[model samples]
Target chain A: MIDSQKPASAQDAEHHRTKMQKRKAVQDKEVASKTVEKGLLIVNTGAGKGKSTAAFGLALRMLGYGRRVVVIQFIKGAWHTGERKALERFEDLVEWHALGEGFTWETQDKARDIAACQGAWRVAQQALANPDVGLVILDELNIALRYDYLPMEQVLADIAARPESQHVAVTGRNAKEAMLEAADLVTEMTLVKHHFKAGVKAQEGIEF
Target chain B: MIDSQKPASAQDAEHHRTKMQKRKAVQDKEVASKTVEKGLLIVNTGAGKGKSTAAFGLALRMLGYGRRVVVIQFIKGAWHTGERKALERFEDLVEWHALGEGFTWETQDKARDIAACQGAWRVAQQALANPDVGLVILDELNIALRYDYLPMEQVLADIAARPESQHVAVTGRNAKEAMLEAADLVTEMTLVKHHFKAGVKAQEGIEF
Candidate 1:
């Protein structure tokens, strides 16, 4: 009935339409089946860039909904990152705390690093307890956990005790297995290629 | 000299400091070697979420530096996404064009899909040609390329011919081999676990 009288292109279009129609029905059913709603514990990890970037993106999204966002940087100083500057524009909705001086190699003091992590964890606990906050971004928390700067059990306990409707995003490379197990969503940004190998320096607004 | 007559913790600390000093020297030299500067063709792909989200985050970073950003959404409609609404706050610095009405299954007309892709590609070419635009995001461009709605050769050619200092981020799943080859940086987001299978619906300000 369809392909007999139609031109080649028309026949192809009709065939495609039929196939798509079947797919749409299946997709619609699957989508309708998902009914549960809960705050998500999101983990972004791996060797590639954008784990923190994507977390900031989620922070921006929460701000779009007129929700409060708390950002606690665990392992790096808030040394003028473009995202930090941009998010700071939403003054009333954002609470940012950069707790560390720099990386472990730069600091080279285990005692100091542990103290800083403990300080950041205290701040994180307060944020988690606040039901008014919509999203809490614990940037580079995995690195602190990996180094055993803070007790992982206490961190997980605090996260579990957070408000039911509050979302949290934890980011860093080499996320712990227990952390991954606790997460509702986990994304690993795998590095396929890097421009640094080709002699490109980190540029402002591109990498920070 | 270092470990003699000292507490165990103090000796361990001294050893750590010495090791870190060596690592810092190596890091500083490697960083000093990279002096070249140029725009990058970045690709974000794979099955995990945040491909487009990361691109938008980069757009926000560019905006923080008071630079221009152009976003061309290849397949998704100009739906009420939180990121779009948030980015639209920077009216003067952002140019956003959401070309397609929806996905292939939703559209189902190859001709219409091709037309939409061509329209978006035209906009992309213009953005690529402009030196003022710091970053141009081709969101879901991989899907369009995978469907063969636009010629991969032409797409790559346009990107290559863009302004030297203009960065471009192409995002979507199943990126073409040629696209990956042409990119200066490539990040493949690998999905470890998603909440959707656990009956969790995509929440507003989280998924969108």
Candidate 2:
């Protein structure tokens, strides 16, 4: 019985050592792989104001990190005080595509509106497929989908198939059910009050 | 002379009418488009501690919106914590890939680390290429790039080639020069004081 006990004790000791060594190795490995790769998607929806503004703030944060970013403005084809000037500062780092035709009803030309949308969508598709892009913002795209100019299924499919580490953001009002369903993050900007309702026009830099 | 004046006045009236019509059209199309397309990249990087936390906050927001969000945690894959637990509630919308193999000296396996990084990058690439994915967050991509595990050039090129409206984000310590140059908006989070330096361990919910 003494001899049996001795062997059992020795075996237990060896097992413990092995477990310790394995754990240590795992810990060591973890330490070795200290780097990480992750991406984010932000959606600012609802009828509130500042959705785009908030998204832009996040974009600025990413940009400060020296990361690559892209912005696609949907219904906002006209020149705006904020993006028009701020985006240009990035120059090579930023690529802006304006949907020159504006909204659907403004032109009263369905063909022209669709063509402009297609043109803008082409750029968006390219940005989505590119892995180097750190951030891509779809400013005011939600309304485009609501107007039936852009296909929702195609958009959702593209997002699902993008690089896992890439980050994406969509800002606008009335976010569709599918978009909300497909998104990893959604923010609804509820409007409590607005200066526009009080007869104040959109101010430069502040509103645009 | 009288006839000439009459013609000039008529032409001026016609010009005024056309200008007014154009202005009215522009005003009528002020409704913002609401559409969310796939292929977005968001980056959260700086000297601050809340980059990842903020990114996760967005992920939670998206989950609440019923969207699926995949988080590939680099350099931080370890025991489960508060963020992990809270995200687990929406298992379908959230996924965590822990690649925190610890610091470089710990593993002493450069080849293995590279391979693992490539594997993780492949997943990221797939996510970026997907259209159905509304948001993709690269948790700590900056660290990987800083360490040179992920090819910076390839990353940049991929970003340049992505779809037009897709959104994306990247977060980490120090962003690369190339990344900042390509980003549309850049924001730097200056570090003030961190609690960790004060001998405080990570807290639940707040730090996790």
Candidate 3:
């Protein structure tokens, strides 16, 4: 018998082998069915803090591939962030625009906010038109849209008009339903726990 | 007379200014209350992609600060992913260990899988002991736990036993409830759309 001299652990191994062989067959078949490829409109939105952080990470990944990426910060324009500083090393591949005047509340000037947004939008439009830019990250664009700083219709139109193979990543919380519907991929970052609630100040490299 | 000089857009701008001023005052006060500082246990989990991607991005940020970082990938050992190759460029500042036999189904040998995990665990424990490593990323550790490749209690205890100032990032899906309860920050990646369903094969750099 197969078990005549086999130890208990060996028998267990034999069972596992048979089980996994079946699983591999199933997974391989499933993976083989997928074949479509195209540029994606990726959205990062929710209550969690990493939406922008994740987008910047995607920006760095694209740069690692020798591709061009542009980051259009829709908020915190006046604040210098760690991602921006770190990406400087990849200057040839990364074009960053921390162009917001500030958050609308921080600036406290609606007219000025509108002017700044319009200017940023113009720059974004230019980046979208460029064929060489592989990815366009509209950082915190959701916050701008939430406050009605920019017209949603205009924003959607611009995104729609971008090059076919140009990937776009939009980040911020409370993304409009329309934005979600328009996206090819959307990730809602759900906050399970936050250190900020425990009076932990945002760390420099980690938080920024 | 007022309308003669001020257009409707100007009137809207004035309204926005007042609203934002009040918001700014409230936010500034709320932000001032947070002041504590301590290391955190960060968890990235869920069915969607980017749990590991976001964690790696976080690791890069830590490395940017000239801090040492280590990544212990507990699954997909046979797969030489693009991220691994890209990260190798930061060899001086980063240590990566892809120590799995393969995925559970592919390996189909529970004993061998357990041995690989235990080996990775030893490396992880050693890294956790080193005070110089700022961040320790236990990539795919959850999958091993899910499959009973390692004891959950041992994993949790080891994490709890890390250096007081050391930050740990655990990535995978179906994280144990106890792990989430112990974490300082947790983000669940909720997938709204995946191109994989559209038959898109994993592309290098982007998928890896």
Clash numbers, per candidate: 0, 123, 4
Name the top TM-score candidate.
1
List the lowest-lDDT window of 10 residues for candidate 1 chain B.
B78-87
Note the Cα lDDT for every prediction shown. Answer: 0.90, 0.60, 0.81
- The 10 consecutive residues of candidate 3 chain A with the worst lDDT sum are A78-87
Over B77-171, each residue of candidate 3 has an lDDT whose tens digit, in order, gives 85436456546667797898989877889878787888999999999999888888889999888888888888888888988888877889998
User: Per-residue lDDT tens digits of candidate 3, residues A79-195?
Assistant: 436566656667787898878977778887776777787888999999989889888999888888988889999999999998877889998899999998898888889998888
- lDDT score, candidate 1, position B127: 100
Better of 2 and 3 by TM-score: 3
Rank list by TM-score: 1, 3, 2
Report the number of backbone clashes for model 2. 123
Cα deviation of A25, candidate 3, in Å: 1.9
- TM-score per candidate, in order? 0.97, 0.44, 0.90
Report the Cα interface RMSD of each model, rounded to 1 decimal. 1.3, 17.9, 2.1
> What's the TM for model 3?
0.90
* Residue A101 lDDT, candidate 2, scale 0-100: 59
